[model samples]
Target: MSMNTLKRTAQIFLLACCCLTMLVVARSGHKPAPTVDDAAKVTVSNVKFEPRTLTVKAGTTVTWENKEGSHTVTSDTGAFESETLSAGQSFSHKFDKAGRYPYYCTFHGSKGGHDMAGVIVVTK
Candidate 1:
């Protein structure tokens, strides 16, 4: 084969390989998680979470702001939980799977006997 023909073929092969690599690398792009502004939010007011239950897509983060007093976000199923939040404080959880996670306030429950309870419904 001529030198020019061989060089052209090699260039085409290199371009194809580069395209394949680029496609593979681009596939790693993941959709960003939804935040409180985009996903869902729960407010702890008067010793209760306003809108006690909510549904959101997987990978969404839900933020709960304490409006009354110190509170603890304890997962009922024990998969995950958060630390105690003081008044005007906040807690957040990111749901990664499709299921219902029932949770309550550990601190409040001891004193008020189950004053808080909620569920996170995750969808695809």
Candidate 2:
């Protein structure tokens, strides 16, 4: 190849390698931590859990913000429980174990797996 062609080819090859390296680094690097608004979240509205079911990775902390009525986040297996929360109140629980955690609102819900109840599924 001509000298100019060889130089252009080398430049293009270096550019391609840099692009590929960036892609690999992006794919393998640590992801950004979940922000407050982006974390596993639930809202208590209309006397029910906004998301009746939630799935999250192990060690994630889920927050429940009570927007309307009085409520409580009581665990079925007694893993973690929150005190009664009034309107505009919030609660948070961290899941360290990988399993299903069923919870309910003591003041306005049941533990029979429905009627204001919620479940959190944690995965490894």
Top candidate by lDDT: 2
Model 1 Cα displacement at 6 (Å)?
A: 70
What's the residue-level lDDT of 76 in candidate 1? Answer: 80
Instruction: Please give the distance, in angstroms, between residue 56's alpha carbon in candidate 2 and its true position after superposition.
Output: 0.1
What stretches of model 2 exceed 4 Å from their correct place?
1-38
lDDT of 1 by residue, 1-124 (tens): 9999999999999999999999988887676686555457889877777777888889898898888888877778787777878888888888889998778888665322256777778887
Runs with alpha carbons beyond 4 Å of true place in candidate 1: 1-38, 110-114
CA error at residue 21 for candidate 2, angstroms: 17
| Candidate 2: tens digits of C-alpha lDDT, residues 13-121 | 9999999999999999989997633368999989888799999988889999999878999998899899989999999998888999999998877886768899999
Residue-level error in angstroms, candidate 1, position 19 = 45
Highest TM-score scorer:
2
Which stretch of 10 consecutive residues in model 2 shows the poorest summed lDDT?
A: 32-41
